[model samples]
Target chain A: MMIISTSYHIFVKEFVSEFRTRYALNALLMFVVTTLSIILFSIGQESPSIDVLSGTLWIVIFFSAMSGLSRTFVAEEERGTSLTLRLLVNASSVYIGKLVYNFALILVLSVIIAVSYVLFITEFTVKTFEIFWLTILLGSAGLASASTILAAIIAKANTKGTLFPVLAFPILLPLLLTCINATKLATEGAFLVEAVKEFQILISFTVVMIATSFLVFDFVWKD
Target chain B: MKTWLKIAVSVWLTGIIIAGIAFPMVKVPQTWYEFPFIPGLEEKARNIIFHVPISWATVVAFAMSMIYGIIYLRKKDIDYDLRSVSSASLGLLLCILATVTGAIWAKFNWGSFWNWDPRQTSIFILLLIYGAYFVLRSAIDEEERRATLSSVYSIIAGVTVPFFIFVMPRIMSGLHPGSLGDEQGKGPVLEFKMAPNMLMVFFASLIGFTVLYFWMYSLKVRQMRIERHVQQITETH
Candidate 1:
């Protein structure tokens, strides 16, 4: 109960600080826009298939995450506020707080990207709103859960900027594959029942990632 | 490692290699030594004795690395960190060997060096995971911080190995044997086929390579320990 309250406070702190600067938000949004434009320009007037568009949508989300999500811990370390954070809350609370914050950030970013992707990319149409939305939700959860601990790990390293995606890509590949497939199914007018395997895998992946992050965050946090 | 174990591994691996290569595929097994000729696999099947064991050893090595990572986090012992890194490096080496050998086998069987098979894709991702692990270790100059962070990363990566190597491949339809909808009945290459003699050699090769990994792991840990001691002494001076 105490842990929950402490983590909630930390989450509030992250939310306030984030909105005040809007640093990660701007970075994430700009990244999505820029990548979408580049993709748009390269394709010229040709409309790619839904398969390519679904895969492209997740690619944008994945790279946008790679660009922005590491800021959660890296910023704390950069400002030397990590020491103050350590003094304030326990390690697990800090982890949970950062995880929630990152999840919320990624969720917002993904929804915006999805909206823009649908608006700009006329070729991309969602036949099944249910599957598309569920994929985004689970993908965000999985991304946040996996990246939060990795953000902590890389924050303590020498080269913070380049290390986040390197460490994240392989760990997140399974999730990406499932998300892309589910998104494809969504675009193809598949029913919810058709994507049951993808959903199960997504749920299990998020659960395992979050549970393991909690288990090991102590070692990464205190040190 | 014990001297007898070392000697045994050397002899065992060599014997398995010789048998795996020299053992002839025949229509029917006249004796215990003859291997039954599998219809599709034929001669290329011998690659399993060498290739499959390396991949198995890779999995074992990653599991050991994760185990030691957990121990290091609990005990704060640098030795366990050393053990963890050493095992991971060996795992990386074995993983590459598996990929290369699998590619060679694929060239003959699948008509290309790269099939994007589920098994191939999983191994490639695994390689990326551990490759990033080493990059993470190198980026941290402080000894304890490096150890702790890398250990944590290893644990995270290790937990996903099952999802990648085992679960993903089985769920996705692919060229690999035992994949979803595989007409081979989804039991993997080991279960549905293999004559008795071939199975014996395969199991022997598996045990041999596993023991070989432990031997290599111990040697690596000792080497790293000596290097650490040397660095500490020089720093003090």
Candidate 2:
């Protein structure tokens, strides 16, 4: 109860700070817009298949994550509030709080990207909205859970910006692959039950990532 | 390592190599020395003795690195950090060797150097994971922080290994032997049986390469220890 309450407090703090300056949100939105337009312009008048569009949508979300999500911890470090947070909050609470924040952030980013992707890409149509939404939800959860701990890890590194994606891509490969497949199936009008395997893998992946991050975040957080 | 162990490893690996290369692949095996001809694999099946073992060693090395990382986190001993890094570097080397050898074998068998097979994709991901591990290690300037952070990163990476190397590959259909729908597939490589003599050499190669990995890991740790000691001595003076 105590941990939950503390983490909730921290989560609220994170949102308040994020909304005040809109730094991460603005950067993330711009990244998504820029990449989507660039992709749209380059493939002008050629209708790429659903496969390519699905891949491209995830790629946009992923790079936008790489660009913007690190701010959760990196901002705290930059503002010199990490010490205060360390002294005031336990490591697990800080982790959970930041994880929730990242989850919400990534969820919003993915939805925006998904909406724009469907609107902009003529060939990309989702016959099954159920699987498509489920994929987005689970993929964002997995991405956010995986990247939160990684953000903490990279916060201590010298090359903060480049290290996040370098450290993130390989670890996130399994998740990305499953998300792409599920999205592909969703676009092809597959039934909800048709993506059972992908759903299982995605759920397990997110659970394992979150559990391991919880176990190891202490080591990464403390001196 | 002891002198006798080193001698045994050297001799054992040499014998395996000789047997692996010199052993004849014949259609019928009347004697213990001759291996049964595995259709499609033919002469290329010899790679199982050499290539498969190296990949096995790679797994062992990465597992060891993860183990040592866990130990370091628990004990806060820099020595364990050294051990972890040493094993990881060795794992990376063995992984590269396995990939290159597999590629060469694939060129003759699959008609392409890179098939993007499930196994190939998994190994490629493993390489990226560890490569990122090293990059993470190098980006930290402080000793204890670097050790702790990298250990945590390695543990996270290690947890995902089974998913990448084993689960994902088998779940997806591909050219790999154990892949889904491979049982009834056209490739005889799926049903290829290993003769008893060939199996013996394969196990022997696995054991030998694993021993060699430990030897290399110990040497690396010792070198790093000496370097750390020398730096401390110089700094004090």
Candidate 3:
């Protein structure tokens, strides 16, 4: 219970700070829009297949994550608030706070991505909304958890920009693969029942990621 | 290395090399040649001597690296960190060797240097995972911090190696051969199709590769330890 309130307070702190600067949010929107427009312009008047669209959607989400979520811990580092925060609260609290914040950011980003895809891509259609949305939710959670931990990691490194994605690609491979497959099924109007395996994979990936990151966060955060 | 251990390794390596080249030429009954093989793999199947053992040795080295990484995290000893990197670099070298040998075998057997098979895909991902480990190492500056962070990264990366190597390959269909469909052993050996002579050479190669991997690992660890000691002594002066 104390952990929850501490985490919530930290989340609120970050949220208020983000609202004041709007740095991450501004960067995220600009990136999403620019990349989305570029993709739309490149495919002008051509109907890409569902597989291409699915792959493109994930690529967009992944890179957008690379651009935005990397800032989660970088902000603390830049503000010199990391040490102060470290002294103030438990490591798990800070991790949970950051994790939740990133999760919300990713959820919003996914919705924007989904909306942009429908408006820009000519042939994009969601036959199985339930499956698609479920994938978005689960995939976003997995991506947020993964990137948050990794962002914490690279935040302390020198060449952070390059290191973040390089470290992320392999870890995110399993999740990305599962998401693409599920999205394909959704695009093809497959039953929600058919995506059960993908759901299980996403769920397990999220659980394992959060559990392991929590176990190790103390070491990473404190040290 | 101890004289006896050095002598043993050299002798073991020489015996395996000689056996690998010579034993395959031993007059096996015609039935041995009659066994099913891929189109151009008849002679190329001999690559199993190098390819299979090198692949196994690479996995062994990776497991060694992860174990050492775990120990480093727990013990905070820079020596374990050195051991971890030593084994990792050796493992990556073995992994590259496995890929090259595999590509050569594929060129002869599958008729293409790159087939994008599931096995190939899995190996490629394993390479990336290990490659990322070094990238993470280089991005950090401090000695102890680099050791700590890289060890944590190593354990995380290690979790994916098994998934990529074993589970992903099984889930995706491929032309790499040996379906291993609920057979007795792991991989092609499970098919139990090899001749007794082939099995003997295979075992010999496996032992030789394992011995070679450990030899490289120990040599690297010693070199790094000496370098660290030299650095500390010179800095103190």
The candidate scoring highest on DockQ is 1
Query: Worst lDDT window (10 residues) for model 3 chain A?
Result: A214-223
- Residue A140, model 2: Cα distance from true site in angstroms: 0.5
The residue-by-residue lDDT of candidate 3 on B72-181, one tens digit each, is 87888888989989988998999999999899888876689987787787778879988998998988889988888887777666655544443364346666656443
Descending-DockQ candidate ranking: 1, 2, 3
Off by over 4 Å in 1: B165-171, B180-182
Clashing pairs in 1: none
Clash statistics: count for each candidate = 0, 0, 0
Q: Give the CAPRI class of candidate 3.
A: medium
Expressed as tens digits, the lDDT of each residue in B1-237 for candidate 2 is: 998999999999999999999988899998899988777678998998989899999989988899999999999999999999999999999999999999999899779989788889889988999999999999998999999999999988878766665446534667655455454334544245788789889889999999998899889999999998998899899
Each model's TM-score for chain A is 0.98, 0.98, 0.98
Q: How far does residue B182 in candidate 3 sit from its true spot (Å)?
A: 12
C-alpha TM-score for every candidate: 0.96, 0.96, 0.93
| lDDT of all predictions | 0.89, 0.89, 0.82
Task: In angstroms, give how far residue B214 of model 1 lies from its true place.
Answer: 1.9
Model 3 misplacement above 4 A: B24-40, B165-171, B180-189
Location of the lowest summed lDDT over 10 successive residues in candidate 1 chain A: A22-31
Between 2 and 3, whose lDDT is larger? 2
Q: Which stretches of candidate 2 lie over 4 Å from their true place?
A: B165-171, B181-192
The stretch of ten residues in a row with the least summed lDDT in candidate 3 chain B is: B31-40
